[model samples]
Target: MSVQDSAETAVLVSEWRDLLARHAATACALDRELSERFGLCMSDFEVLERLAEAAEALRVQELAEKVHLSQSALSRLIGRLEKAGLVQRAMCEADRRGIYVTLSAAGDERYQAARPLHREVLARSLAGHRPAGG
Candidate 1:
């Protein structure tokens, strides 16, 4: 490759790494705070937020996609939420093989409580990275 091409590639790779690092740092901060204040991890909070936005129960596969987690990982997360009485699983009547997940009343309450904290942290983190007047 030409020297210009190599330079461009290097810049792109550096930008990608920087993006990933920022995401990891912010996620870690949010996870720590959520765990300490709400007894919920970042994944748990993400699932709850998705459920809260849905109009009805969400299929496990659909939820897995929304949360960017593998189906098995999401299933395990749901299992933990279920044990905590924060969510419940139900069989789809029309598709007997399918399962759906819904946030319980307790889960709604928990999400409501945590929503402000989540927003605050996200806002603060994003603001720190924003260019002035941009």
Candidate 2:
């Protein structure tokens, strides 16, 4: 590769790393605060957040697209949520293999309660940081 190409690659990597670090920090803050305030982890909050946004139940596949976790991992997380009465899952009528996920009333309440803290954490964590291309 040309010298300029290598230099550009290094800069890109550095920028990406910075972005990842910011995400990690914000996530940690969210996890800590959410857990302390509401007995939830970051993953739990994220799933609840997504479900709250959906007008109706979401197919498991569609939810998988929205979250970062793999299918198996998301299934496990959903199982936990279901056990906690935070979410409900049902088999799709048209597709036996497909499952739909929806937030429970309790889950919606919890998400609403935590929403402010979540946004506050994000604002504080990314307070002075700028996007790579910004």
Candidate 1 colliding pairs: none
Looking at model 2, residue 73 earns an lDDT score of 92
Error of 2 at 52 (Å): 0.9
Report, for all candidates in order, the number of backbone clashes.
Answer: 0, 0
* Strongest candidate by lDDT: 1
RMSD of each: 1.8, 2.1
Per-residue lDDT tens digits for candidate 2, residues 19-89, read 99998999899999999998899989999999999998998888888988889999999999999999999
Relative to the true structure, candidate 1 reaches a TM of 0.93
81 Cα displacement, candidate 2 (Å): 0.7
Backbone collision tally, model 1: 0
Per-model CA lDDT versus the true structure: 0.94, 0.92
Candidate 2, residue 88: lDDT: 95
